[model samples]
Target: MTAQTAHAAPSTTAIATDTAGHGTRRKVLWGAQILLAAFLLIGSGLPKLVGQADAVETFDLIGWGQWFRYVTGVIEVTGAIGLLIPRLAGLAATGLIGLMAGAILTQILVIDPAWSALPAAFAIVFATIAYDRRTETRQVLRSLKR
Candidate 1:
């Protein structure tokens, strides 16, 4: 075989291997996102919906009333569901980032200082997910513009 042909074969194989690795990484990330969504829905959303003691206390601290708690709960649940859908995950993550930002601000300004980091961490995670899915988000926005 020609020397050039031998070099070209390895280059093509490397590219194929690199693409497969990327696909595996993407699947792992997608799985993690799904798990996060499920946790948010079950752990946070349900408690608020049911008026759990801690959730009630948190709303009291926010001073926004029970109605606001219900609204926030609904938003969380909806966002969590949206996160499971490939096409909507970016939008869902964006919405979660807003919610987490509010939580972080509240923790810093009104609630306990030690708790602020929790929401900040969640905000970072949501931001990462949003960044990763930016292309899908752009496509969604483009469709809406039409």
Candidate 2:
């Protein structure tokens, strides 16, 4: 193998790393995204939107006021919807990861530490989705540059 041939492979890697075997992987990601979206929209976001007792109380403990709850609900709902959009899933998952981090911190600091488990679990799932869709995320960013 010539030095030229050895170096040529590295140059093609960027353009060649397409979704050759990501069909099954992507399907799995979609499944997770759907489930998470439903969970967030129904179990979490809606409760905050409607001022469910538990949600209201939790935010109360955080001492951020009920308005913060509304903002959080909006972010959750928006992120959930974005998860279902193929082009936005990566960015959506990335955003959710950040939201979950805040939740985890709140739970540990102001609320029950045990409650942190839920958000931590959610963050892990979002991380996986974000990682899987990174290439798509990059493509989206590239398009936005125009």
lDDT of 2 by residue, 48-128 (tens): 999999999888889999999999999999999999998899999999999999999998998889999999999999999
TM-score of each: 0.84, 0.83
Error of 2 at 96 (Å): 0.6
Q: Cα miss at 54, model 2 (Å)?
A: 1.7
Q: Backbone clashes in each candidate structure, one number apiece?
A: 0, 0
Error of 2 at 41 (Å): 0.7
Best prediction by lDDT: 2
Question: Please, what are the lDDT tens digits per residue for candidate 1 over residues 1-146?
Answer: 99887766557788999999978867876887888888889999888999999999999988989998899899889988988888888899999999998888888888887998987987887887888788999999999999
